[model samples]
Target: MNFTPLHRALGLPPCPLTDEILSDAVTSGVTETDDLDWKSELPPIKGLSQTDVPKDIAAMANSGGGMIVYGVEEHGKAATGRSDAGEFTEGHERAYRSVAVTAISPPVFGLEVHRLGTECRAVAVVIPASVDGPHLIYKNDFFGAPIRNDADTAWMKERQIEAMYRARFNERRRATEAVDSLFAEAAEGRDTVERAWLIAVAHPRVPGALTRLTRDEAREVFNDARTITLSFSKNTGIHPLDNVEYLNPRPGLRRWVAPNAATGDRSIWKESWVSVHHDGSVSLATAVGGHRMSSDGYWEGWQVEGRGVECAVADFMALIRAAARSLHLDEYDVRVGVEWSGEQPLSILTVDGSGFPYDGVSTPLRAFTSARSTVTASASDADFHRQTRELAEDCVNQGGITYLHVIEPLPEDEN
Candidate 1:
C-alpha cells in the first residue's frame, strides 16, 4: 500500500512515472510479492469462467490490498515483457469494476484503473485494503475470492474470516470517532460565525491508504497548487499562496490554501481550502463570504437574474477537480454541501447563453453532482472537460435551460 500500489505493480517509484520507469523495470528487474502481482494478459471481462481476474483481485483485497498489473509478460513473479495491457479495450475498466463491485462483499471503493499515458496497454488496477474485509469472492472465480498466501492466492481460513467480520464493527467505530474528534479541528481557528461555508468532505470507503503515503508525497501535491485551478475565457484563479508551509496536523491529514485573501489569512475557507488524508482520501471547501459577482459579471443580483446558480456550480466544479489532481486520484466519491450563514439564495438558475426563454428558473443544488472530471484534471484525457460539464448541462437542461455557459465569472461585490 505504500507505493501508490499501482506504481509498485508497474515496478516504478512512488511518484507518477514516465515510460522510462517501465523500461527500467524490464531491464533491471521486477519481482512480485504478496502485495504485488501481475498477469500476462487482461482477460475478457465477460464469460466469467474465462477470466482469473476475480481471483487475483479477491486475493489482493483479502490480503490487505495491492496492485495487479495486467497485460504484461512475467516469469515466476517478475514482470518480463512489454505493455500487454495495450490489448485491452476502453470498456475493460468498466467491465472489471462491475464484477469487482458485485463479486466482492462490502464492495471495494477507490479502485484506480489507469493506463500509462494514452498509448500503453499495461493497465494498473489498484485495489485498496478494506477495513470491511475478508472480501469474500461471492461470484464466479472461486468459492469467494481467495487471500494471498505467500506469493500465491489461496482461500481464506475460517478463523481469518471470523476476525474480519468482528473487526468491521471496530472499523465503523473508528470512522465515527474520526469525524467527532476531527470535525471541530477541521476548521479550528479558521471558523467564523459570520462567514458562510461550502464544505466538500471525502471519506474513504476503504481506509488505511494514507498510512502508506509519505509526508513528502503530501507536500509534493501541495506544491502543485500554483497551477491547479479554474480557467475560463482568459480568466484563471485558485493559485497556491507563495511560501505557504505544508499543513500536516496529524498523520494522514494535510491542508493548504490558495492565495492570500485581503485579510492575509488563508487558513479558513474564505478563498479555498484543500485537505488530504493518508488513505489517499481528500476534501476541499471554499467560502462565499466576501464581495462576489454573478455569472455574467454582475455583482448585485443574488436572486433576480439567478446568477448565483451558475457561479456556485462553476466554483464547486473547479474546487473538486483541483482536489482530485492534487491528491493523485483518478476517481473518488465526493459530497459537496453549502453551509449558509447569511440568507440563503432563493434558488440556483439554469441558463444557456443568449436566448433561453426560461433563463431564470428554480434549480436544485444536486444538478451539479453528475460531472466528475473537469477540464483542469487532465485536458488530454478523453472527454476530460465534457465528462463533468455534460452532466451539469443535462441536469439543468432538463429544467428547460437549453444552453449552459460553464465559464461564469465570479460576481462583483456590492460595495
Candidate 2:
C-alpha cells in the first residue's frame, strides 16, 4: 500500500507517521477538517503558564484524536495555498510533553511531536486516541474540555463530556475484545487440542490508529525466513511441511501469518506462528506436545511432544523483535499472559529436566507446583532465566534432591 500516491490524490499534510506521507498531505489540496488542524508556529515555551496549544491537543484527542501540524500555515480552509510559518526549536518535544502532563487533566499517553518535511520546515504532533480521555485543558482558575468541530475548536457541553467519561469503559472493552478475537480467528480450523501452545497477545495502551501496510509490503517483511524461528527439543519429531513458510491469506490485510500450512498435524507444533494485525497488535504462538514424567519415573507417565520451556529467552526476544518490526513500533508497553495446555498433564516429579537436547539444565530436576505466584518485571528487565531464579525463592528448601515444592506458604489472608 503506497500512501505516497494516496496523499497526492487527497492532498494531506504533515503527520507523525513519516515525512513522505506528510509531504503528500501538504500537496493533496485537502482542507482542514474537524480532526485536522494547522498552526503557523510551535507553541511558545517561555515559562508560559498556559496556552491555547494544549487546548488544541485536547480538542483533537477528545474528538477521537488526530494530528496537529505546526509551522505550516493554511491558506483559508483548503490548504490550496500555505507557507512555512516557523522552524522547530530544540526543546519543543519536552515542551509538548509538558503540556500533556501539566495542562491537560487526566493527561494523555503516546503524544509524540516530530520535525517533518524538507529542511525541517514543519512539525507534526501525533496524538493517539486514548482509552482514558475526554482530556480537559486545566489551567489556573478554569476547567475546560475541548472538542474539535469542523475546522474549529470548541468547548464540550456538560452532557457530551459526561458521555465521553461513560464511553471510556466500552471503548476499552472493545479494544481488548478485538485483540482476543484476532487470536481466536488466527487459529481457526486448526487442531491444537492435542498439542501444547504458547499464545502471546499485545495492544498499545493508547489506541493504534495506524495506516495498514500493503500486502506487498508485508510479504517483503516476512521474506526474511528467520522471521519465523524454529526450534524443538532433540527428542521432538516434526511433520514434513517444511516447505510451507508464510502467507498473506486475504485482501486489505498486510499481515504475516507464519509457518504457512493448512494441516493440523502436531509435527509443525514445534515451530513458531505469528499473526500481525493492521492496528499494530501482534500474537505469537507455538504448539507442541512434550513428554512429562509422573511418579512412574523416567519410563514415562504423561507424554506430549514439543512441550516445556526451551530457549525461552532467545525465542521470545526474536518474536518480540519481529512483531515490533512488522508492526512499525519502536516501543512496547503491553500486558502478556501465557497459557500452556496439552493432551496430558506434565508428570513433573518423574521426568528429568536434563532430557535430550539440553536447552539449559545440566542436572536432572523435577518441579512440582505447590502454590501459585505472580512474577512481575518490565519487558526490558525479565526473562525466563532471570525470573526462574526469583521463582526459586519459593523452593529453597528442596535442598540437593533437585526438586521443587513450596518452602514458605503465603499467609491465608494474602492468599
Each prediction's total of clashing residue pairs, residues at least 3 apart in sequence or on different chains, is 16, 12
In model 1, the runs with Cα more than 4 Å from the true position are 1-12, 15-31, 45-50, 70-86, 91-94, 106-124, 140-143, 179-182, 186-195, 203-254, 263-317, 330-415
Candidate 2: TM-score? 0.60
Give TM-scores for every candidate, taking all chains together and pairing residue i with residue i: 0.57, 0.60
Error of 2 at 25 (Å): 7.3
Candidates' C-alpha lDDT: 0.50, 0.50
Model 1, residue 378: distance off in Å is 11
Model 2, residue 115: C-alpha shift (Å): 2.7
Q: Give lDDT: candidate 1, residue 371.
A: 26
Candidate 2 steric clashes: 12
For candidate 1, what is the total of clashing residue pairs? 16
Q: Which ten residues in a row have the lowest lDDT in candidate 1?
A: 299-308
